[model samples]
Target: MRADARKNYDHLLAVAREVFTEQGADASLRDIARRAEVGLGTLYRHFPTREALLEALLRSSFNALAARADELQTADDSAAALMLWLRETVAFTHENRGVIAPMVSAIEDHDCALHASCVTLRAAGAALLARAQADGNARADLDGSELFDLIAALAWLREQPSHAPRSDRIFGLIADVILVRHPRPEAPNASGHTGRQPKGRS
Candidate 1:
C-alpha cells in the first residue's frame, strides 16, 4: 500500500474502533468515515461491510485474549483462572455491543476474516476448561463448547433492551451451575434445626 493509503487505513481503523466501542458493531459506517475525515468510498475500500470492519477491530482483541488465556493456564488455580478469563470475555462483549452476533456467525464461516481469530479464542478457553476439569476443580461433564455457548447467550441477553440493566448476579447463577461442588449439608444448630423450620414458625 502507498504511504498515504496506509495512513488512511490506520486512521480508519482507529476511528472505527472508537465508534464501534461507543455505539456498537452496527454503528454507522458513514459516521466512521466522517470521524476519520475520509470519504464513504474510502471506508468501503478498506472495509467493505460492517462485518469486515468489526472483524478487523476484533482481531487484535481476540489475539490479546488468547495470549491472556495462555498466561492464565499456568496460574495456581485452574478454575479461578478459567472464571477470570470468562469474566474478561464478558467484558469484551459488553464493551463491543452488537458484536456478539457477528462473532457467533463468523465462527463457522470459513470465508470470514474473523473465523480464525474466533476459533483461536475458543481453543484457548477450551484448554483452560480441560485443565480445570483435569485438576478436579470443575465439572467434568461440561466442555468448552458449552461454555462458549453460555457466554454467547449471556452476551445476547445483556445486549437486549429488556436485559441491558442486568448485573453480575445473572452470571453468578450460570457460573454456579457450571462450577458447583458437592454440597455438604449444614451442621445442625443447638436446637438440632437444620434451618428447615416452617416459614410461619421461624
Candidate 2:
C-alpha cells in the first residue's frame, strides 16, 4: 500500500481499539470512521469486516504472547515461567476486554477471522502448561484450552462494573491453584502413626 494508505490503516486500528474498548465489540463502524477521519469506503477497503479488523488488531498481541511462551519454556524454573505467562495472559485479556465477548463466540465459529489466531494462542498456552506439568508443577488433568477459557473468564469479570479491585488477587489465587503442585496425603511412619510428632522428637 502507499504511504498515505498505510497511515490511514494504522490510524483506523488505533481509533477502533479505543472505541471498541469503550463501547464494546458492537461499536458503530461509522463512529470509528468518523474518529479516524476516514470515509466508510476507506474503512471497508482496509478491513472488509469487523472480524477482519479485530483479527488485525489482535494478531500482534497473540504473536507476542506465543513468542513469550517459547522463551519461557527455556527458563530455568518451569513453574515460575508458567505463572509469569499466566499473569501476562491476564493482562493481555484485560487490555482487550472488548474483544473477549465476541472472541468467545468467534473461537467456536470456524468462519471467523479471529478463530485461527485464537487456536494458535491456545496452542502456545498449552505448550507452557505441558512444560509445567512435565516438571510436576501444574495439574495434569487440565490442558491449555481449559486454562485459556479461565483467563478469558477472569478478563470478563474485570470488565464488569465492580467497586472492588479484586481481579489481580483472584487471578493470583487461580494461578496458584492451577499451576502449583497439590499437597500430598500424609503417610504413616515406621511405627504406623500418621499424626505429627513433637518438634523435639524425630
Candidate 3:
C-alpha cells in the first residue's frame, strides 16, 4: 500500500473503533467514513464490506484471547483456567457490543470474512472446557459449541438494560451449572437459597 493509502486505512480504522465502541458493531459505515474525513468509496476500497471491516478490527483481539487460552492451559487448576477464560471471553463480547450475532453467523458461514477468527476463538474456549471436563471439574456432556453459545447468551444478557444489573448473578448461575464441582461458592440468591445444582442431576 502507498503511504497515503496506508495512512487513510489506519485513520479509518481508528475512527471506526471509536464509532463502533459508541454505537456498536452495526454502526453505519458512512458515519465512520465521515468521522475519518474520508469518502465512502475510500472506506469501501479499504474494507469492501461491513464484515471485512469488523474482521480487520477484531483480528488482533481475537488472536490475543486465543493466546490467553493457551497460557491458561498450563495453569495448575483446569477448572479455574476454564472459568477465567470464560469470563474473559464473555467480557470481550460485551466490550464489542453487537458482535455476537456476526460471530455466530460467521462460525456457520465458511465464506464470511470473520469466519476464521470466530472458529479459532471457539476452538480456544473448547480446549479450556475439554481440559476441565477431563479433570472432572466440568460436566462431560457439554461441548465447545455449547460453551460458545453460553458466552454469546451471557453477553447478550448484559446488553439488555433490564438484565445488565443481574448479569453477574446470571453468570455465576451459569458457571455453577457448568462446573461439576462448584469452583467458588456463590452467595445466596434473593430467595435466600444457595446455588442450585444443574438440572437433571441429584
Candidate 4:
C-alpha cells in the first residue's frame, strides 16, 4: 500500500459508504468510483468484488457488535441481555440497509468475503440466546440459526416502504413471543372460549 494508493482506497471507501447509505448495498460500483473521482479499474483493484468492499466497510461494526454481545453476557438478566442484543442487531442491519440478503447468503457460503464476519455475528447472537434459554427465560426449542433468521426477517421488514413503520411493533411482538415470561395471552372468542376461534368459524 503506497501512500497514494492507500489514500485512494480510503477515499473510495468513504465514498462507497456514502453511496451505499443513500442507494443501499446493491448500489453500483461504477457510481461509487465516479463519486470517488477514481476509475472503475482502480475501484476493482482495491475492492475486487461487492462482497469484498462490503466486508471492508462492515468489519469494524461487526467486530464491535461481537464485543457488545460479550459484554451483554455478563448482564444480570439473561433475557434482557438477549433482547437488547436482538434490538441492536436488528438496528445494525437496518442502518446498513439492503445488507440482509448478502449477510444471509454469506453465512452459508464459506468462500464469501463476508462469511466470517456474518458467522461471528450469528454466533454472538446465539450465545445470548443460549444464555437466556439456560436461564429459562427464552424458549428452549429455538436455536441460534433461528434467531439469526428472525433478525434477518425483522431487518427485511424495516427495508420495505410499506412495512417499515410497523417494524418496531413487529419486533416487539417477536421478542414477546420468544421470551417465556412475556407470552401472548389467548384472546376470548365470541363464545367465551379463551382461545382463538377457527378462521372459518370466526
Each prediction's TM-score versus the true structure: 0.83, 0.81, 0.88, 0.88
Candidate 4, pairs of clashing residues: none
lDDT of 2: 0.85
Off by over 4 Å in 2: 2-4, 21-24, 182-202
Which tens-of-lDDT digit does each residue in 19-51 have in candidate 2? Answer: 988987779999999998889999999999898
- Residue-by-residue lDDT tens digits, candidate 1, 163-187: 8677477888787877746568989
Q: How many backbone clashes are present in model 2?
A: 0
**Which portions of model 1 miss their true places by more than 4 Å?**
182-202
Candidates by lDDT, descending order: 4, 3, 1, 2
Return the TM-score for candidate 1, rounded to 2 decimals.
Answer: 0.83
Least accurate 10 contiguous residues by lDDT in model 1: 174-183
Cα shift from native, residue 136, model 2 (Å): 1.0
lDDT of 4 by residue, 113-158 (tens): 9999999999999999999999999999999999999999999999
- Angstrom error at residue 4, model 1: 0.2
Give the better candidate number (1 or 4) by lDDT: 4
